[model samples]
Target: MKRAAKYIIGVMSGTSLDGIDIAYVKFNQTAANDFQILNAITIPYGKEWKSALKEGFHLSGEKLVKLDADYGIYLGKTILKFIKENNIEKVDLIASHGHTIFHNPTENYTFQIGNGPQITAITNIKTICNFRVQDVALGGQGAPLVPVGDELLFSEYDYCLNLGGFSNISFKENNQRIAFDICPVNIVLNHYVAALNLEYDNKGAMASEGNIEINLLNKLNSLSFYDEAKPKSLGYEFVSETIFPIIDKFNLSINDILRTFVEHIALQISKKIESNSEKTMLVTGGGAFNTFLMERLQSHTKTPLIIPDENIINFKEALVFALLGFLKDEGKINCLKSVTGASKDHSSGVVYEVESSKFPFSR
Candidate 1:
């Protein structure tokens, strides 16, 4: 008999501490490069959870472990609630791109908390998570893993750029997908904006008022990460260490800082897009909503930029993570060797199963 289609919930919490994006998808393997998104939803993080995750990188070993377990259980409960509300049935597994904590691949250590085992135990569902560790272990950046999804799901776009907590772009070069983090986005923007007791620069209004600090802009545009080659990724540590200090030196107002950083972001992103002029680029993620930033980028590049629906822009990463899980469950290569600079294309993520018979979780 033919196997039934698999229903999976893909969970993701990006570096911006935006919240967990859970996508409930029914995936069918029609062909190698064909798949569809059935249904999806983004769950906003509560204040307490957001605060805890924002400071997660500073926690100690034991506290971090506790947070991991607690967060996992929280995710499980959230998933169960989502399923009930949506009336979803026949879920095969939960694929989670847990919140990234420490991502220093040069040190040979990377951690994405939200314990998968705890998730399975609480939800009584099979879980697949920690998608970055193995790729890093094989001497890769352990990031920008969504390119495979971009490749398969939206292959028509010549370039796929996501402006989430960080700005990263992926595109075909000599028949290979090359992707890397361009610059910090909301992670840095939100940090400064939060100091003003605001959550974010809604619609980029605050950034639109202030003048760009030419000195700060020049200094930011000259950062070493910009000079680095492709297949590289960035983490929170880079911002805390390299970006924050420089921005802190100037005693500028919040709006000025926002303005300068927005320009810096536009400069970095446009430079990459200009490097190739042959095709249309699909841009998504939270930063895509930043009108000022988008305008700045448009000023610098000549290539046509296409912004999809709000759902696709917001949930693309989550949708891609769901695709990652589907590929992993089928023993297919999900991690792109070209994008991550891994030794080879590999299936990444650890599967955890709950020791329960009540929920009837099956593939």
Candidate 2:
């Protein structure tokens, strides 16, 4: 017999490479989609790990495979540490959104490192990971997977927008879920700010101080990605190839570049959330902490923005990934064809379970 209520650990390493987010979530099927975040923490990547991941994408296939396994062991060790430090022993599953290395759906391939077997072997917890590969296999973008959680867990709001490495929004459209990436956020901002030896612009202060380069902002806003239809996503490759070269050509001050790009991000996001009138947009992720960016976004639309507690703002993705795992465990449609343009709605994830595993919790 299977249990309805589960204690699961969700682990995520995003494109921003900020750190690994681990959330211990208790999902109760009181009626479906009811859950609580019991504990969550982000372990900032050390200098070595950060450097390795930053360069891992460019490695040869042979080297990339090795790096993938190594990263998996690293994630396993980190998850173990998180569980030990928090005294979390009872867990049904571990869902890891291993760091995304390459994501290009047009080529019909996407890869996220950190081996699932390595995680299960090291942590002794059943694991579900590599959630995107299946979606891509079905001729979809294999991204913006958070919408399934948004549809069930956060449907009260008109929009569920996450401003992480990239800005993505999910909402119900004509009784179907629709979601897609809007633009780059921390992925671009952090790249420029690294020149100043800062991890990020505190509350977008640096961007607030600088003047917007109108030319640059206009160019960025005019990028073809904004005009494309839904069921789309962005990756590090797009940024490194498309975004950086354009900005570098201008040779503007770092401050100006930051300010213009922030403006560009706000403009692009406003285009999506401000369309429907009087809607409540739930904003989360690192970008939500950027005061200047938030102010700019608010100014662009009359729609009210609802930002939850810091926990939700920071670790909501991890929490939602846990929900995705729960859906997969129940053999439900966790990845929507409508949201991802896949061939069909399907449960997307590879599960690894220990032999005759005893679930620590009793329902």
lDDT of each: 0.87, 0.91
Model 2 misplaced regions, further than 4 Å: 1-4, 275-277, 356-363
Given candidate 2, what's the lDDT at residue 322?
93
lDDT of 1 by residue, 1-363 (tens): 555677878888999887888887777666545545566777788889989997888998889999998998898888888888888877888899999989998788789998898888877888999999999988888988999988888889988999999999998888998889999999999999988778789989999999999999999989888998878899999999999999999989999999999999988888886544677889999999989888888888888779999878888888888889888988999998899988998999998976755767666
Model 2, residue 155: distance off in Å is 0.6
Q: What TM-score would every model get versus the actual structure?
A: 0.95, 0.96
The digit string of per-residue lDDT tens for model 2 on 274-349 reads: 5555789999999999999999998888888899999888898999899889889989989999999999999999
In lDDT terms, how accurate is model 1? 0.87
